[model samples]
Target: MINADARWLRQARSRLRDADPVLARLIDDRPDFDPRAWMAQLPPMDLFGALLFQVAGQQLSVPATRRTLARIEELFDGRLPSAAELLNVEAGQLRAAGLSWRKVGTLRELAERIADGRIDPDGLSRLPDDEVIAELTAIPGIGPWTVQGALLIALRREDVVLPGDLALRKAVKAAYQLDHLPAEPEVLAIAEKWRPYRSLATSYLFSAAIEFSAAIEPAGAPTDAPLRERSTMAATRAGKGRPR
Candidate 1:
């Protein structure tokens, strides 16, 4: 759990509410919002496992990602595997667990780095966001989006945002009433106003996007409707590594 200062939390809320009326309304509508609450329900993951989950989830729906992860955990006695444990597992077994060839290679590479001390989860935690990104992205298949997810879910950084995320762009458009989805640069510029709390702000935006999606999903659509039917919801929910 993150040790948040009470004063910082209060200040972030005040500043965010003051900076944007839309977000202010969101804050008002959801009084019980705790951005970090989603983390409570996730299976505990170390930094490597968090990165693995992020990679596993990319471009996939929340439920699909969970299914894949469940299969993976089943391979390791119903627990998220450590780097060493992952290394011990055969590539074929991981492939059987629904991991793509690319994802499997990425995981193996990540395991190797962790095992060799080239990528230290503990050390990465202490570095600035840019350094963390640079170091992690050095590994294959670890892109900016993956690192951003890690920054939020694993390191619990305060100011980071995932401008590269399509869901976030859609959320900005819907929540801010933009005619078109904001581009990456536009998202970054808008996020600047929510400085020092982008992570928290993102959480609220994601929640708002999710509520908006649920309100709009077809009345009789299957509860297990594929994620494509609700792209925004999947993306927003997946960004936090959780189901809506």
Candidate 2:
């Protein structure tokens, strides 16, 4: 994973502080927050692995996603498969590992394209964000939200946001004190002020939402589920990758 330079992070924080009051308070309240801390729990992922993560996470909860990923890793001796390796595996193998038929097909198609040189994972990193989105979104089952999550997790793009994320929409409503949950467009409109540091801003809002959810949940209720859900929402929806 990429690490933002200390100076760069400071600058991003300062910019967000001036850009919006809610984020300003959020940033101030957590003086030593590490926005990327959640990633530590995830396995090391290449572009293909990240895409697999996004695909497996579709419409599933965080616990379910992790379980599926664990089974997939078990198939490869405890590691995410390379594109070639994935293509070598039968579709039924992935299905047995808990992936939906649609996800299995999507992953196989993506792996084939990458393995055959139709899609260049290395080259994608060098392209502008929009160009990368354009190229990847052309694939079946891969949408803007999926590509956006890959941009953040795989490429570490700084300015990306997931307006389509349901948890994020709820977080925006809570953070901004909106009476109703904001739609994708409204989320985008409000996030306009967070340009250039949106990923970081998004992390803050996600953290806040998770905390609030945990606080209100019954004492015996499962806590890690919600935490993981919110933490990975940038990559995945309500409990799945952003509801597409």
Predict model 2's lDDT versus the native.
0.76
lDDT of 2 by residue, 1-244 (tens): 5455877888999999999999999999989887876666567888888888877776675667777888999999998999999988889999999988988989999998998899999999999899998999888888777777788888989998877766677788888888887877899999999998999998888777765652122121111122222234543321222222
User: What is candidate 1's lDDT per residue for 169-209, written digit by digit as tens?
Assistant: 66788888888767778989999888878988887887776
TM-score of each: 0.86, 0.87
**Residue 244 lDDT in candidate 2:** 20
What shift in Å separates residue 99 of candidate 2 from its native position after superposition?
0.5
Give the Å shift of residue 193 in candidate 2.
0.7
Model 1 scores a C-alpha lDDT of: 0.74
Error of 1 at 95 (Å): 0.7
Candidate 2 is scored at a TM of: 0.87
lDDT of 1 at 13: 89
